[model samples]
Target: MNLTWRSSSILPRTSRFYQKSFRVVSTESRKESAQQEQEVTHDQQRDPVLSEEKKARAPFLKNLFLGRFDKDVLGFPELNKARQKNFNAAIAPALKSLMDAVDPRRTDAEGTVPDSVLKELKNQRILGGTVSEDYGGLGLNAMEQCLVAEFTGSDASVAGIVNASNNMVIQVLFPNSISAVNKYGSAEIKQKYLPRLASGQLTAAWCLTEETGGSDTTMLNARAAKTLDGKFFDVTGKKIWVINAEKADLFLVFVRIQDKDELHNPCDITSAILVEKSEAVALSPCPSAGLRGAGIQNITFNKAHVPVEHLLGDTLDGNEIAFETLANFRCASAAQVAATMRGLLTKTIRHCIDRMAFGQTVADFDMVREHLGKLAVWTYAVESMAYLTAGMTDSGEYPDTQMECAATKVFSSEKMWSCLSECLVLLGSKSCSPKEGYEQYLRDSYCHHHHGGANDILRLYIGLKGLEYAGKEMQALVKVMRHPYDNPSIYMKKNFRGLWESIRFNKDNIKLKMHLYGHIHPTLKHISLQPEAEILERLVLRFPVVIEHVLIEHGAYIPQRQMLLRRMADCIIYLHALTAVLARASRSYCIGLRHANVE
Candidate 1:
């Protein structure tokens, strides 16, 4: 009998007698083939010409990487007045009641959020803030969702529950699936699911993470085999650390299609299926150090039958849906982190003011003040970026914000962990005690660093993705350089443009044209003249040049240099934060918000 590698039928087969001897060879060959196939698929996905033509608007940070500052992004975003009023009048009271009912210490000790609190959450429509009003939801926009997330995020467990439903499930379901009728869920599926989800009559879990495929969604081991009738799929696999698993009435599952033709490219083999809770679905609680009340569990699908219409998108569209969903989710998580940091800062400040130190309250000490100052600054920066990104999402101008969202998540999560650690130190032994709840906050913050995507991995993604775009832009320049004689006039034109830019810089013309000084409020004019602002301007001007040089130097092998990529990511993140801070401060000053000058 002929034995073949299951992943690809094109591979050469071997007799049963030689299977053991050729096992290593077959495995290695399969991996190499898979890698080659994946690269080609990714290259197609990253086609610059295609992307540029399809793009309706360029994202702020990505444009910065290309050395063009989008002046429009300089305007700070504000919540819609009508939405703000609605939130205050309706959602605020409900949120307050939910908060009042929740006891973090009790929730942690019992390893479960009380059912009463969950009911309160549903009654408040907190679980369905982002769902459409037509579907029995609040129909909050991106900025509004962020505001609500901030309130829930003060308790990490609650944030996890709400986000899992709103960000992952609702986001993926309606936007990607229903909105694109030709591509994803049928009308019947939408009618069946949306209203129930919005009413909180059903809860959903996003089940993309497998034990083997933690951060790498493409490596998912789950398989969905179409039954002979072709009307249903038998999904079989186990997903670990699935949030809302214990309570989810519906699950959005990602699995590889067990079809011979689709198996050739692993990247394109994944599909998403909606599986309603059934006897075929088994759940086992997976306890964690934090987010104990989040109802995280290991879920096994033992031949769970899902109707063909329940498929979220077209076959092999799982990766796209998953990524788009995650990008939005990560952007929103920054808001959660900002809220968590703000809460920690508030608690720390109150404690320092009341607790005595050497001669007076701890707040009187220079060291304590320094820590507080750092925490406050970071909190401000994170909050600024969070809302700015939310505004970008809400405007619907930029079709892609994957890189920007990743950068925000990385920055916010890290800063949250750092800020909480500082708070812990400020509170000393008291922080370690469960009574203070600082330790709980610290544990929850630590989890954010790895929640959506690990910080280190995301850093590489941010750097490499930027580099990919820069590299594409540099291709023409490289061709000119490689054979200057072949394209003398084109080369000379390029040279002259470079020379003109340099000359313009020396004459301060570039600075005059590119400066954001004109955009800020008159009262904040001095801020534009500050050294930090000057440094930011210099970095913005210098970054693209540095990026070009790095690409020229490293070429295709740059992804392997993790340290360099990390540094690149750090620089981009800092620039983004500085830009956000300036925009926010300028808006505050212009609006004459109280104490705006202090910002």
Candidate 2:
């Protein structure tokens, strides 16, 4: 059987270049075709002049891979005073009250959140934090939502409950369902669903992960068949580890569209269907080591009837919808992890200050101080990155932030896990006691490492996404280099510039043309200059050269080289962290905020 797959969903608008179709006859051929299609798709998406304009207007970490850095783009984010104040005045107190009322230990032991707590959350509008006010939600922006996530995430189970509704469902549903905004859903569906969803009258579960397809949607077994009249779809599949499944009134399900002609073959096109609770849907609790109160379950849809109008996006655009939803979810996960780390660090610090060891407080020990310092720095960096990404999302300055969101998720989850381990070490065996709850925190952190997508997979995504941008920029140069005789003037001009630079600078020590010295605040600068600042500048300068070399050597096969991808991801993550830290600290110092120097 021949299989054909086409995706214009990667970009919002499909270019004429992507209209061409290809056929795949075998697995190997499919892989090669997909890669070729992806490269061409990327090339079409990034026109040279437009790419430069986008880089300047919406500079992100990917730009660093191509040796572009705009300090102003990395400037510290500022919150809207009105929104912050509104959140503080209305939301903060409710959150405190809810937190005081709910016991995470009890919730974990029972494997469920109490109805009273759920009701309280509904009343406080926490469940609909990101939904628009017209939909009976709090109308909070991305940063504000992160702030709320931070508060709820101090407790793992609570974070799970809240995020399942706010981060995963509402975030995905609202934009796709609102016709006035995205034109993906009918007005009837929006009016019928959004209000109930926002008011918490109806809860939602995102059902995308199947037993066969844990993270890779291509392996999904779920199938949806359109009825003869095309008024409704019959969906049949089982989704694993579905949060809020036990009580969800609505399900945002992903399934392949089974064509009549391809009855024996696996479907290639995926679609999202809004499935209302019905007798055909079955649910069973899925036991887990952590986040027990999140109401996770395995849901089997046996010919579930879904209206055609309930489709979230285009018929063959489930991949893009899923990717975009996961990206948003990852940004929220970063905030949750950051908050969890902050709470853990606070507890560990208090314990260290009070506990005695070797005739002195644990806090006084050099090793303990080192652990605490590292925790402090990691916490700060995670928080900085979380809000920075959140601000970018809210500001709408950046057109594509999937890479940034992935980096934030990877950095926060891994750092939080490490920090939790350190906290356990600092607190000793007592920390593992059930009553203390530190062990639970560690377990939840472990879950987070694999949640959304595994850190390793996200690392590869970051590397490949950045590499794609870099490769597009180098395509023209590579073409010229390959056939220099055909483009002699351009080749000679490029070589002459390179030769001039080589001749001007010593072979061993080349001067960097770009530096952050002028961009950073005066307080961070000194007569001799800070070593860290200088190191960042050097790394920034050297990064693009390294990317070019790797692209030249590996070419299109870089995706298969996991180790190299991991290393590239690490560098990007480090650079992003350093940039965020410096920008935030500089802003803090300039504003004369308390303990700015300490930060």
Candidate 3:
């Protein structure tokens, strides 16, 4: 290698002549070289301290990495921090006031939380976070939405007032479907709908479910056909459980486009646009055990004329749109439910401290303390996992998201319900009665199981996905163990520290797998299936391929020092589960500590 050194004085001459020479040469080549240097400098500026801090935080990061799917793929800290600051300053207070209004605390009467509550959220632009700023929406990131959802769990009904409207619209705005909105929906749709939908001027819903088929998009029975001028469809169908439908200004209805005279074609389901309530034949409210304030209704579209532009995406791609939207919805649902548990824990701790038994506070009892501890631990673990997943999404890591979303929703919902029950028991009779507010929390929290997806279905998904990852890691391990020469002990020792420093890296990946599966299996059944099994097999097969490439790329430079791979791997795996539990457990502790120390 040749090296040249120049002092600041010589640098001036070097720069002066270099600039003249560069001007004489091709400008494009110089621009390309400068751009490459700029990119390197930009990345360095983005995290000058990150490399150092990451080294110190290796053990913690490693803990997060073990035993879960790839979530770091979507982690976006810059966006997350920006949104958090905005919510704390702008949206949080507005939401707090809305919660107070519909709380039943002021009135001591029972009726639906009014549309005005949602209007207040709109007025504050809480419902527009996902919309572009140009459209009068907040345009917040995924983690920001997660934070907003957490704060709302302080009062879910009010959160529903805000989120239900936003979710209905934003759910349709990902990369794939935005084109449909732009092409088919009128310019008027963006002008009229974007601003209000962004500003909460009008709430919305997509009516797709039926009594016979909910998630099974192929089983859709609703039909739409072209009528007069190639721009309209006279549609008729019954849509069950349409959220925010009764009062929403718009409805995106999925109607099956007929294949000749067939009742249904798996690929023929198409969506129609319905903007007029009058055209909507009838909207009847559905009675519900929970989410009472949500305007969930059954809507009948009888000879409803829908505009051609109202058809979203391609006619046949309706099912694809629905599945993708549902996946995102389920992931967000996990974040929302985790917040509910945090809020419930706060309320329960206060009850335990204030409510006495045997001349001591209920929280003072051993069993009560143990229950609270467990709940706090579980809640923390859920939040950590949920936040990690949300961060990944905001960062645009989409591939590994499917499994993480399923796991987060399942773990959070099940843990929250259990936490809610413990708090109910601690509160005694008042928790069960509507007068005390605990019953309502219980009602709303339990309802989450049915909202995005049934708990059983989510469990099946988690079981299969977990097995798939475990299988991949195991196969990778076996390959490395067999080809010991490929990763010589000396090479392993050299890069050992750096590898351990990375939160995702783990050793004794086998022991970590056993520990993870041991806990996961009790919670889920039917883990062995061909789809997941094949995925695992493929992952295992790729282990040597990936290792070979890495070694060839870094050869002598690769680090291989090892200190506590087994311990680090174990910690990494357990910590992911631990953080979720701790969030649940700590909320109660915070509440109890505050109550006992204060009046």
Candidate 4:
């Protein structure tokens, strides 16, 4: 008799696991939209990041990670009465009905979201949440949209659909439709696809990877040939790892465009073309260990013809649009991961409380409590980071959101992986069943590291971006030193400010105290936590020294030094997470939620 690892853990089903660990859970809504959005989304306020000139400048992470302690965004956000009502009316019921109805096991076995569920989700207006109502969509803002993704992350099949839908809603349809058409596409292209995408008449798949390239866009082998008429392009190539490949009506294919006149190694430019699935666009289901309900797939395009109007942007701008889309998609994916951890922690805590072991509840055990504590801390941190990133983008508060999103993605994705393992252990024998959610959770969580951008590539991106910012400052100092005699003012101004900062920077660090309102009630705006918050605050404020140390040593070539950069990037990721947890803890404290303490 062959026994698998999972089978070995199925301890006769008569143990404590049978009654407590297998319980399923259900999943919330809108703002009195504006008030709920008060923390970061003040429409009347202008964000400096919205300005292209200021956006070109890099932000000093010093506020959060040393030099100064910025308290403006350090606390959890408040959800007002209006926002609570808004959430209840628009989002809560729909998600509850959906989560309770779908069984991940069935979806996994079938490898597709059932048509009825998709239709219901469409009716709920979830797919169009990020699109503007003017464009015939629900037009929920980024934070709200990410909030839904968080809830959807609880179940495996639901998580996949939510993840896929989020990329399309936030990246493809919302931004690409507007940016590509208004900023880069011809008017003819804008009119052709934007409305259709907004209204959900045609769903889209973002296909960038191919046999020759995954992260290296330069190596992509797919090519497009322009016909003499200039009205259409004949495309030919294969693309892999396309989300929603089998279901989407339109394919956003990233390809190399070169004139048919050039024959040998002639691809010179990267571009995007929308292809319709047919015999020319052959899709095969690349079902994976997880996200099976999403129909994760690959496609082979055999000389598919795409309209000239379907081209996304100017050839030069295609890569730009793709990278921007990737950044936004990554942020959304991280938010979902946070939600997944939230759900896992919730159910595991419930299981521990209910399951009796050695004549006492599992929660009575010290090890069990410790695991739950870690999960809670991680969940809060990730939730804070994910939503804060969303708020920054939606509110236009952070111009350099790319690195923040990437860091959040890496941190949350990896943390969520650990979270799955912890939840499985706490669930005991119940987790060993194939039908139990943990098996699916483990499989699905693997994609977090690979999707949007692989953790490795994103880590390099974090290091590279940071180095660019560091270069500007270092160059300024160098310029002052080189011209000390020529411009005494330059030398004095640079050195004196530096000297002043050094004088103020004491070795005994104290948090810059400020009142923050993260909860709906303003009277108790300064809710405080214990030693954990203080530790996290200190760590966040000190970690910039680590970044500074590594940058001083490695400089611009940090991108090539992958291993060292990864360590630096991880440090950034964890520091950012700590800040997030601190902020989230404030919210939890104010709202009177359990485990608000990051113990």
For all candidates in order, the CA lDDT equals: 0.74, 0.73, 0.53, 0.63
Tens digit of per-residue lDDT, candidate 2, span 53-72: 22214448889998787565
Model 4 C-alpha lDDT versus the unseen true structure = 0.63
- TM-score per candidate: 0.85, 0.85, 0.65, 0.78
Model 3 CA deviation exceeding 4 Å by range: 1-79, 104-109, 174-192, 259-267, 270-276, 461-599
Model 2, residue pairs in steric clash: none
Deviating ranges (above 4 Å) for candidate 1: 1-55, 176-183, 259-268, 482-512, 527-530
Error of 4 at 596 (Å): 5.5
Over 118-171, each residue of candidate 1 has an lDDT whose tens digit, in order, gives 887887777876676657777666666777777777678888888878878787
TM-score of 1: 0.85
Question: Which scores better on TM-score, 1 or 3?
Answer: 1
Taking every candidate in turn, the Cα RMSD to the unseen true structure, in Å, is 16.8, 13.3, 15.0, 11.1
Which prediction has more favorable lDDT, 2 or 3?
Answer: 2
